[model samples]
Target chain A: MKAQRIASLTFTALAIAYLAGAFFIKEPPLRQQLGPDAFPKTIGVMMLVLSLLYVRIEFQRQPVKEDDERAAIIGAEEKLSDYVDYKTIGIMLALMLGYGLAFESLGYPLATFLMFMAGIYVLDLKHWKRDLIIAIIASFGIYFLFRYALRVNLPIGVLKFLFR
Target chain B: MDIWNNIVLGFSVAVTPFNLFLAFVGVFLGTVIGVLPGIGPMTGIALLIPITFGLPPNSAIILMAGIYYGAMYGGSTTSILVNAPGESSSVVTCIDGFEMAKKGRAGPALAAAAIGSFIAGTFATIMLMILGPAIAQFALNFGPPEYFALMFAGLTVVTSLAGRSLVKALLATTIGLAISTIGIDLQSGVSRYTFGNLEMLDGLEFLVVAIGLFALSEVLANLADMRQAVMERLSIKGGLWLTKEDWKRAIPAFIRGTLSGFFVGGLAGAGAAVASFVSYGIEKSTGKHKEELGHGAIEGVAGPEAANNAAAGGAMIHLLCLGIPGSGTTAIMLGALLMLGLQPGPLLFQQQPDFVWGLIASMYIGNVMLLVLNLPLVGMWVKILDIPLYLLVLFIILFSFLGVYTVNNSVQDLLLMVGFGIIGYILRRLDIPAAPIILAMVLGDLMEQALRQSLIISDGSLGIFVTRPISLILLILAAISITNPYWGQLGAFFRRIFGQKTAA
Candidate 1:
């Protein structure tokens, strides 16, 4: 009922996807025996077969050992809350993505500062004053290091005239 | 005697003012990170590899190699003072070192550890100098198929040796090979898995993958379990001189541990942690202080500390000679080599003697620097441990992001890194060894190229792999490696049959 058997199932799903994609992959005709798709197709089939084998063995073995780290494969089948603080990871990952996308538009300083503050908060750092100063200092510190020291032309966003 | 010439050339390169400065910086950073609680040498090297992008390859490796052994010298600090092992290799140090610290003998414990590490470091470096060229010379005879076979054997052996479940580890390795097949096929100019996207044409960046799979995922996993660890400060009050009794007991342990660590760490897959454990076990069994094995015995601290540093020196052999990394940190160094357009194999030694020998020389000076730094600046080094874990975590993630971004100035690479990081975290959760995947990814194209080249040479006959003596021997070794893990189960089955026969 939970997320049990996700790995084998996920592997099977990906293999089928790969095989279907392999069907569409165009190749320029070549004289050598093995084509470009040959290696990937073999690998996809290998993955499919091994994943099926794993699933079969998993089902056959009853009373899965809790100590087995492999149990995370099938054992994630508990409740939704069982996923430990994954929300923080998801939020932080999204923030990083946002930082990357908005980097050129928002400037390195602005983007880095925002990301740092968000990261600190998500990581459960409670001192807002300290976090703010640290974030500002780190953002500018890295900016100067890259701009002057390493000499990379970073984006300036809306506040471009300051450097000029 | 012949090594003296190489040593001279090595000193000529390493003693350059710039290279020496980088070595000091590397050791300084390495000791700081090693003295920290969660961040160890692997993380230190991974986080720092990007900074060396601006330097020459020779200077870069001198810096990286400094960090490598420098961590070994510093790891003993945390174990002795805080009872927290800074790295996995130093875990054995914590047992006796902490007890000694509790008994107000931290100064002598620290001194013995430093002295033992210095002696072992010098010995292992000498051994590496003597042994490395000989191994590389032997490897010069290898052709493509032999390389493939040797790589295959190494990959399988290392994977099987690393984790509990063979299936998961193999799966990780296979996934890495598949990832490596992305981008245009180099030989035929045929595109395989580009998926009609121009960005995908370049395939995945190795640095991005490394950062994601190692640095990013580690942050994600640890984010959930963030808690403050208040380490009670232990002071080194007494003089640094070791008593006659301390030196008498510690010297033999240092010798035994250094020899054991060197050989064990020089093997294909055995690493420093294993070397230190074996050293501790050997010390306990064969020492004069058998009854004082755990309760603050000087040999316990001395032996493992020596083993820890010597093992690092020993691990450099494979990285320098055969191009295979014995552990995760060495894999990062290999990634750096690839980024710098330097292929690391026998030819590297033949082609770049100055680079190789300079690296060998830097280890000697780096260890001495570590001993000097640890003794005088110990108070400053221990302060790094008190930095909030959350801030450290933020810094690591941000640093990783900046490093990947600057490498190519590509947002896509950043996205891909986060994706791989998540995958890495899942693999960690599933207990699939990540080392195999990194090894396979690094070797994937070369492996495929070797196979194809072998076939072409034999005019499409696969028998070329078996007909060549070296290749055949390597393939046999590969088969043995695959079966090595199952030997225990097979032995159990045979014993059961024999026991039943006796009963009947």
Candidate 2:
């Protein structure tokens, strides 16, 4: 119930901001059939109305307790935290962000290799030798497929000397 | 005679070695994608869109279409073996499919699903050939107002059917429309919301959003759950053939499922998931051995498996005939067609008969290939389940990045994809669907164009929408779709008032 409230409130704020932004769109010098802001303005109003309806619906619904049917199924009282593993998700998100940041600078092979190794570590796969071989093969195999077979111009970055 | 001629033309194109090879490869990869959990047909098609960039338009569509129906064939394997559906449409199959496997009847169960799917696919394709040209001819008369009304109805249907809450579905739809409104306005040539970034001028690539929402978000959600799958090894004790009694019960169920699935799938919002469930319900009520449905009954597996595969073929009718997609995967296929410089709709029949017919013809061959691949090669597909889940997640992430980058070589797009991925994950947690957003985005620009065009034609009067018969009928449908969920409450309210009046 709290998550639902938070999501509705966030949508309300976004709807307001978007509506305000829609008003600031500059009118074109040449007149047309419909202005550019017309569609956005309509969509903004729809979002606002829908968000308010969502808030109302969320409020009207009964809040589920910790010891509800869901908890009984698991044979223990549970909270939201017990269902989701935030740490693993956080690590995966960080790995993705780092890979995107270093994709061009670190080149495809090195960055992908690092991403795979980090992913394996986060998953707690303890076989280092097998993990190393899998990561190396995956990173370079994909690079070769894209770079040579598909003819995509992937960046070489620090590995330029080796390629040359 | 004309239909016969077109089929010949289609066969001529489909029989070429290059096209044949691609069709085979497409169904092969599609089966692999379907055998693996956490990757549905929508994500499978989105992930492969980049690889099809270099192929000819006809071949590209053929390959993608192969994946669509081929996934339907392969989705049953996981359900029968592991009691887990490979995709949403196969959920019902798990009921009897897994039960049969446990009872040592796995061979007959597997054979029933394969043979039923083949029969359904062939029947639906024949229906498509007979019905495609007629519908396209009828839709050729649609003007701007009619087009706007039709697309409006499509959006409303999808929004109504998606997710639990109507408001949340509408919110997702509005967000998609807002995203589509970015970049330069085509009519006025003025930028709307670029925010000074050159990459944003393209208004966010469809493939990036698709991959992020369907593929990347799935990986993230699975990571959070981290539920390990325990694969139980089940072997087919008997030969891979159905008994006489099994055949007697399954054939009627196959016909019923195929008929229901084809028409239901042609509706704008209803897809294979709905079709399969509807078929299961029908079988429960009407089958000969109704009480045996959940207890290792072959009809239970045969009905849904056939319905889903037939739904794939049925979805193509709307996509090819009217230029509107009936499902999420078909929406992505529509986006691919637009990217490939081919426009689907009425005129496409006249302008690109070979391309259209060739795709239709390839479906016939693809179904045969799928049956061959699925029956004898069932053991090989089950081996795919043994691959570690962590490795799959990492590879999916890598492919998501690679797909986005190869589109424009833009790092900004990669970041944007990750952003959508996070948004998709959040939405999934909230029970708000992501499919409607993608459907809305694909239809957004086209709907807006039709609306503006209609207004222009009507001299800015909204009354033009209702003045035409077809447009008015479609708008009425849209209104009914939007208000469909409230009908039960409305009936009770009216009944109470009438009852009180009678008592008084």
How does candidate 1 score on lDDT?
A: 0.78
Per-residue alpha-carbon lDDT of candidate 2 for residues B94-138, written as tens digits (9 for 90 to 100): 899999999998888899999989998998899889998998999
Note the DockQ of each predicted structure: 0.31, 0.41
Chain A of candidate 1 gets a TM-score of 0.76
**Which has the greatest TM-score?**
2
Q: Stretches of candidate 2 above 4 Å error?
A: A63-82, B227-233, B267-269
Worst 10 residues of 1 chain A by lDDT: A72-81
Taking chain B only, the TM-score of every model is 0.94, 0.98
What's the interface RMS deviation of candidate 1? 5.6
Pairs in clash, predicted candidate 2: none
Once superposed on the true structure, which residue ranges of model 1 sit more than 4 Å away at CA?
Answer: A1-4, A15-28, A45-53, A62-83, A124-130, B228-241, B498-504
Q: What are the lDDT figures for the candidates, one per model?
A: 0.78, 0.86
- Output the worst ten-in-a-row residue range by lDDT, candidate 1 chain B: B222-231
For residues A1-164, what per-residue lDDT tens digits would candidate 1 score against the true structure?
Answer: 11336776787687677767666556756666556666677767766776776566466666344325422221211111234676777887798778877777788788889888888877756787888898988888778888899887667786698878
